[model samples]
Target: MKLVLSQEQRELRAAVRAFLGAASPLPKVREGYDPEVYARLSGELGLSGLIVAEEYGGAGAGFAELAVVLEETGAALLPGPFLATTFAAIALAEVPDKELLTAIAEGRIAATLAQPSIDLIADEVAGESATVTGTLAQVLSGMEADVLVSPALTGDGVIMVAVELAGEGVTRTALETLDLTRGQARVELAGARARVLGPRTEGGVGDRLAVALAAEQLGVMRAALDAIVAYAKVRVTFGRYIGSYQGVKHKLADMHCKLEQAESIVRYAAWAADESPGELPEAAALAQAYVGRACFEVARDHLLLHGGIGYTWEHDAHLFYKRAKTDEVLLGPPRVHRARLAESLGL
Candidate 1:
């Protein structure tokens, strides 16, 4: 498979990076979710529609392109419903609802998946209706989503359902998290009205989500490595650059190696999503298993290398560290993914 990015993809990455550099600076990101910024990302950059089909008002890009955009978002620590909306779109695209796809592509609505529980059954059920109960903890962008794509266990099987958050019996409470740029919330669904999408598969949506998250982690790792390296080069200690020291040089070298490895794994996962659906499950699992912990380590090293300044809230080092920690467990811990990878490998 091709590992290099196409010219168009490179250009798209540059444009997205430039936009986020200006609009999503650390201060703006810390301010929390801004609907206006979301609108601009959707309307001006057409990011909301990145992966949707052209007929549905999207750019009709593949997972690779989507990965590029997500990487930039992660680096900028953009706060909003972007991840939720994108994940919803990825799941919904499998359904036959053209209207919902169109709405999402046009940025008319925001959506996210309610974290499925162990029971997997709807808390309450009636004729053609399901009530989702239980609190979904750490739902990314859960508070601001207009729609929640959730799964409910029914008599037939586990079926994906679309629940309107504006409807009754649904309560969304914002939760404080380590990474402010990525908002989290607790969603309480009490007999929430819902529409069935289709039967849920074991690894369908989860694989896609993992690949997307890996892409984000790749961005975080790269940004952290770059920041630390830049600081090492300029910061002087004892009449010599800190980077000139063997210990510091080795740390930076290790961070670069990890970043490169993570990038390759993430790119392969994204490519597998589009080019080889059958390979996506293992690819995604492998990406998360390695990249998740690697990114977190890189971020941690970044903070440590920065010495005193990195610990402060004012500096950007902590933001990346927080994001890396949160993302490391967002889907599941690295061990979880490693277990899946081992199973996939028939071990």
Candidate 2:
């Protein structure tokens, strides 16, 4: 299969990058979320529903389009619940709720998934409803979400549910997190009623999530590498440009190699997510395993390349570093993805 992006896809990427460059610049991202900017992104740009169906009031695009948008967002470090909400929309697409998807497409309701923390207390089976109780200690964008796509353990199997965050028996509290651009929250549910979505699968959700995140990590690595390379070209030390130094050139070369490898894996994984379900598990694992570490390394080097300025609060280098570090652990780290890949390969 062709892994390269089409001309249209390239144009889409350019458009998204330009829009984000002007609207959600690094300074704007540092200032935090802006509702007005997000509205334009969701409504005018039609990003929130890139992967949603046209019948559901979305753009009826594929994962490839969504991946392009994700890369631009990652580069800009756009604030708000775009990633969380888009992820929820992706998860919900498998279940296909018309009204909910429409709401999401319109950017009226924000949503997030309760993962690695939610639990099942009881399954009433009262006409597509279940009673759930759990505390999600680190839900990304949980405080801003209106609904949660939660998976809970059940006696028969694992069931996915859609829980209303504003309903009774639900409480949300913000949490201190490493990434300032992305917020997390603790959600406590006490016998909250939830609408059943479907049975939970083993690798489907995880693989998709991995591919999506890998795309973002690719963006981060590219941004860091580009920034450092540009800085190296001009910054002078001892009356000589840093880019002329062999050591700096070698490091930049290494970072470029990693970025290329990451780009290939991420693009392949996204294509698999869209067209090759059978290959998604392996592709996703590989993408996450390599890209996560590579992204972090590039971001770390980005900071190091900036010298003392990178460590200061004012420089944007720290932002990329923090974002990379947080993303490295957001889905249980590179080791987890590597382990998953090994198991999948029967290692």
TM-score of 2: 0.96
Query: Residue 11's C-alpha lDDT in candidate 1?
Result: 97
Worst 10-residue lDDT window, candidate 1: 116-125
What are the lDDT figures for the candidates, one per model? 0.86, 0.86
**Local error of candidate 2 at residue 74 (angstroms):** 0.5
Q: What is the RMSD, in Å, between candidate 2 and the native fold over all Cα? A: 1.5
lDDT of 1 by residue, 4-117 (tens): 899999999999999888877877877888898888899898999899999998999999999999998888878888988888888877664677788888888998876645
Identify the leading candidate in terms of TM-score: 2
* TM-score to native of every candidate shown: 0.95, 0.96
> TM-score of model 1 relative to the true fold?
0.95
